[model samples]
Target: MLPPLSEKELDRLEDLLITYGNDYSVLNLAELNGFFTALASSPTTVMPEQWLPAVAGGKVPKFKKPAHEEAYTALMLRYASQVAEELGDDVDHFEPLFEESEGEEGSVIIMEEWCFGYMRGTQVAGWAELPPEQDQLLKAISLHGLEDNFELLDQMSEADIQACVPQVTEAARRLYRYHRLQD
Candidate 1:
């Protein structure tokens, strides 16, 4: 199995995205990882060319540092491998982007981004004629992306929001599995 992403790696990636002047959205490494996994699971064939532009939030800005670009490429390649392994069910280890350090509010933000990225990836991948159930799941995820949960965040207790994390993560996983099953 491939190793999990280190905090340093995520920090480096974030720095690279900033240097590249990301303007489309605020996406963390975890979200990117989720996006790539969704792309891999998608029924449509997605090329690196398509993914690069989509993740760049529409444009692929030139990297300020050549080394950072190379690192980013390597990381993407790893994500690709992860998709393959996941589809085969040959790997079991996985980590959601949000963990303990992110806390409830941070977790909500990251998960929303992650779902948004997955939705974007599926669209870019040209996912075709999804099964009814999967299509419904896609719609739900899209809603999650568009919803202004921040205001609600205050109304809900931290523990209550955090409690929803597992369910949200499971939904993503189920969506991923649903696509694979259709294959």
Candidate 2:
């Protein structure tokens, strides 16, 4: 099995992404984690060719060196593979790579980018209308990820948002398990 990305490698990958030209909509590390998780857990396979462009904000970036491009691709594939292995080994322990910030109460999770990435993964996979239960699970993710729900989220209190955290986490796990069962 391929090894997971080390912390240094992850930082390097993040650096590469940040430097990938201002014109491109490259995903940050958190979003990339979410995107890869979604793809790994997707009911159907999404080819790298299809999702790779999506990661670069819908267009592939031009690297100064072919070696740089190769390295970038390799890092991404390895990270995605790591996510898949984690999920495959045990969905129950799967954790989203969410960022956290100090709030008045404590550390608050910043799930927006991750959720958005997951939603993008679903889009890339061309997910069809799911059954009611599965759709509900997907909705848990969309509630936090999609900008369209900003107004709704705005009205929610911090406590409410916090409450949704476990729901979102469980939703991801259940979604993965649900799809795996079908396989």
Candidate 3:
């Protein structure tokens, strides 16, 4: 069991969020091969709880259509499930790139999700937040550095879904950054 992010590192993580605009950039790094331990143990170093209350909690109040936050949360959950299953119990042993998703809810009042998954994640709700009936949202999803032939959310067994979870998440996290932060 690694320790949580220290105050100093948390500050840097916060700064990183401000610089990039989205938190996923810092959260998805286990694939990088370095700093995995540091991130897993102390994800708050990069993902800062400060942002959670504003974004994840009902504080900021989305109050808009097309809830991007919820989409992001679901994507994170998919990643967590994959990481938990693939990495198994060893997940927490290292600095988990993504924490397990926990306590998620959607409603008309507050869009912000309580979000405890993905080590910790953010949530939101809004109109058209559904996964889409015709593969629209899934189409938007693309895991990084995946097999060219690999199709996301397509025909496969539970085992396939499980294996693709982390890859799917990496894609979402990357897309989230590119959509919001990356110019």
Compared with the true structure, all predictions reach lDDT values of 0.64, 0.86, 0.32
Ranking according to TM-score, highest score first: 2, 1, 3
Superposed on all Cα atoms, model 2 deviates from the true structure by an RMSD in Å of 1.5
**Per-residue lDDT of 1-183 in model 1, one digit per residue for the tens?**
786456686677776666664558435765676677677677666778878877777877677778878987776666566655654563234444553455535533335666666667777887787678777666556644545545665687666655666665666666666766643
Worst 10 residues of 2 by lDDT: 19-28
* lDDT of each residue in 115-179, candidate 2, tens digit only: 98889888888888889999999999999989899999999999999898888888888888887
Of the two candidates 1 and 3, the one with more favorable TM-score, higher being better, is 1
- Which RMSD does model 1 reach against the true structure? 3.9
lDDT at 99 for candidate 3?
27
Estimate, for each residue in 1-183, the C-alpha lDDT of model 3 and write its tens digit: 333344564444434334334443333223211122212222133342343343323232242435445544433333333433433344323232332333333212110111112212212111123333212322322222224424643455445544544443443343233333341
Model 2, residue 68: distance off in Å is 2.1
Off by over 4 Å in 1: 1-7, 83-95, 99-110, 147-163
The TM-score of predicted model 2 comes to: 0.94
Best by TM-score: 2
Question: What are the models' TM-scores?
Answer: 0.73, 0.94, 0.24
By summed lDDT, which 10 consecutive residues of candidate 3 come out lowest? 107-116
Candidate scoring better on TM-score of 2 and 3: 2
Kindly give the stretch of ten consecutive residues in candidate 1 with the minimal lDDT sum. Answer: 90-99
Cα error, residue 159 of model 1, in Å, equals 6.0
